[model samples]
Target: MESPATTKDTASRTQRPEGRPGYGQLLRTDGAWSFLLPGFLARQPYAMLTISIVLLVEHTTGSFGLAGAVSATAGIAMALLAPQSGKLADRFGQGAVLVPQVFLHALTIAALITVASTDAPLWSLFVAAVPAGATAPQISPMVRARWAARLQGSPLMTTAAAFESVTDEFTFVVGPVLATALCTGVHPAAGLIAEAAVSLVGGLIFAAQRRTQPASARAGDAPESARSDQARPQSALAVPGARVLVVAVLGIGMVFGGMQVSLTAFTESIGRPGINGLMYGAFAAGNMLAAVAVGAIRWKRGPQTRLLAGYPALVVAAALVAGTAQLDPWVLVLGALGTLTGLCIAPCMITSFTLIETLVPAGARTEAFTWLTGAIALGQATGSTVAGQLADRSGAGAGFLAPFAGTALALVVVLIFRKALHTPHSGLVAARGVGHRTTVTVD
Candidate 1:
């Protein structure tokens, strides 16, 4: 007969082999690809179509003021509701939250088309905008959380993130062109219809996946390890470093929003309204290039270091934009400068996202990601509002310079708080030891 101590040791050795798969193994499995494909397809076209219609409405109405207001309203509503939506995902599973939200969003888009076609009052348009904004599904966060659950700690997480960034770039590039084509070539309503169809189909497909479904609501039926994994840091807002990441991304969004208005206004002021597309395209192209480059370059540097390093590039880009106020150069030259200046965007966003992924607990991932999205929306709204007012008061030249100044200010603030924001205890290190260790330390 075996001694009790020997038997206990033997059981421990036997059980160790049954441990959960690491991030690498998860990515290599079929499930990761299945989850990723649906998310990418669903998001890319929706983003493209939505932006196109928003711009088309502004162009058609001949009121940047109304456009700005509508955009701001939608943005503010989305920002406010996004966190709650994330919580809903946590409570009711991503599929349940996402599928219904996508359907509602589709209906909202259809309604907006009707409202735009009629001679509706501005207030009516604003009122319709509320539902449109509020129902904007928390697609990115939900998809990310699903990916985290499936892939855990593998390179798939990085790859999936890079894929998302690339898709965003593709959307910016393709969405505007498609929107413009629809608005100018076909009817503006066609663009709205197309967006609705994409949302409905994509949303439904994503929601149908078995892996994406919520866990069964039975006592003790929950995946014990997964539940405990994310339970600790669900309230990420209280974390100092996470707060800084949100603030930094918000400022970045504001800069981009202002830049959009300023760039258009400047193009029009310089007798090149037709070239607005070219300038914007160039900027997006730069960002795309940077994203691809960064994705290819494997870096061991912490997210903060990457973020801090990228800031000066943005500062230079902003300075260049400010200088464009007086440049009597060819349109192509100006476009090139704008494109080169935009190189920092992808790197900055990627770093911020990676930091959030590393810092926030698994269960709180959706909420934390939603906060980042909300920050971007809020920033864009602020920037657009400020730029529009400045453009009306001064020339578009002055408006174009505004984002540069804002970006410079943001850079300074981020640099000042770099040490606090980049501290080791505040980042991905916190998430690494959850199951393996007894005590998890969060800063």
Candidate 2:
């Protein structure tokens, strides 16, 4: 049924003479902009959630401790619930999962705002936060799933990985800054109000892109056996590779968490707390730049090979950062080291995502992505806690050890499970057999 000319065009798109597709080429795909634009907006609130919750709750209750506890509750809820949301999206469809969730999330935000504003019991803020966090759409993972669905076999999948990494970095860098500005400059509740608004509008638009969404295991369409299979419970963690990635990403999360707390401590110790953002910005800029560069290159090595190589590089980078923090502890020195550490982050992140695509079954791809997201979140939380304790007890730069420890743990896992990651080819076969359309990949 395939025409020669059409097939030729597909080949041209997938296997370019340059070997790697550029962002311009990747964006040229039909309907990409539709989901991408709204998805960008939809994902921003995730970054805003912590800062906004902290500011509004603190303003109302006049207690940073209470605000932190309430924010942690939301963070914990989101981390636990996101994978389940992804699983539902896998079964029922993204649109079906997202439509009600966006509205419910918006309503919960409203309720949370009301409770925070009123002289209500502190328990009500916690209660309002759970549903708000639980219902927030996991748009980043959903968009990545869309890219996988659209461009699985193509080299542009590589580009997509890079672009998503950059997008994620951009959102984290911008979102908190925006949220902080709104909370301080405008009103305490203004940041949260904006979060609710964008989440509602952007999530709805993202959900409306039905044509671009990945195929779900809907009941009527699939064979009875397949339907029965879907009925049975499945977790993405059932895949060993998924578990490995969770651990690896958890380490990456620790790196972020460690850096956040350690950097803050370092800045405050020097009495130049204002430059904290600039230091972190240097790190993020390196990550974004590296992601851009990595995506532009063509590689003969598979993701597994690249990942094995990248993780060690990350470990080394983290160690240097740790050493610099403990020894010299100068602003410029740490800034350069932070940038070096960030340069190492994107490749590993891009490869981890690429490997997950290779290794995960399509039926649970979104859930698998969410698991990694959740892992990073958990890692960050743990890293922050440990780093904060260290900063308090051992002085300023000692908190840097947390990131090194995290990277070392990840490296050990990757080296130990190197054999398990080679199952990508078999994973693809398994996914295809399960009624999901998947393309063969060289990796």
Which of the numbered candidates is closest to the native, going by highest TM-score? 1
The best candidate by lDDT is 2
Q: Lowest summed lDDT over 10 consecutive residues: which window, candidate 2? A: 428-437
Count residue pairs with overlapping backbones in model 1: 1
lDDT (CA) per prediction: 0.65, 0.76
Q: Output the TM-score of candidate 2.
A: 0.77
Clashes of each: 1, 0
Q: Write the per-residue lDDT of candidate 1 for residues 285-392, one digit (tens) a residue.
A: 887788777666546556677788887788787777667765655677667777776687878876787777666666666667778878887877667666666765
Q: Which stretches of candidate 1 lie over 4 Å from their true place?
A: 1-28, 153-155, 211-221, 229-234, 266-275, 298-301, 326-329, 358-365, 426-443
lDDT of 2 by residue, 1-443 (tens): 44566456555544443433666777876678989999999999987876577668767875544565576567778889987888788789999999999899889999999999998888989899888778878899899889876764565665676678789988867776677668766888988899999999999999989888888876356445546766665677888888898899889888876776677567767887557667867777787788766665555566777788999999999999888887856789899999998899888887787678667776566567778889887776567556666766787788788889998988899899887787646433111111122334543
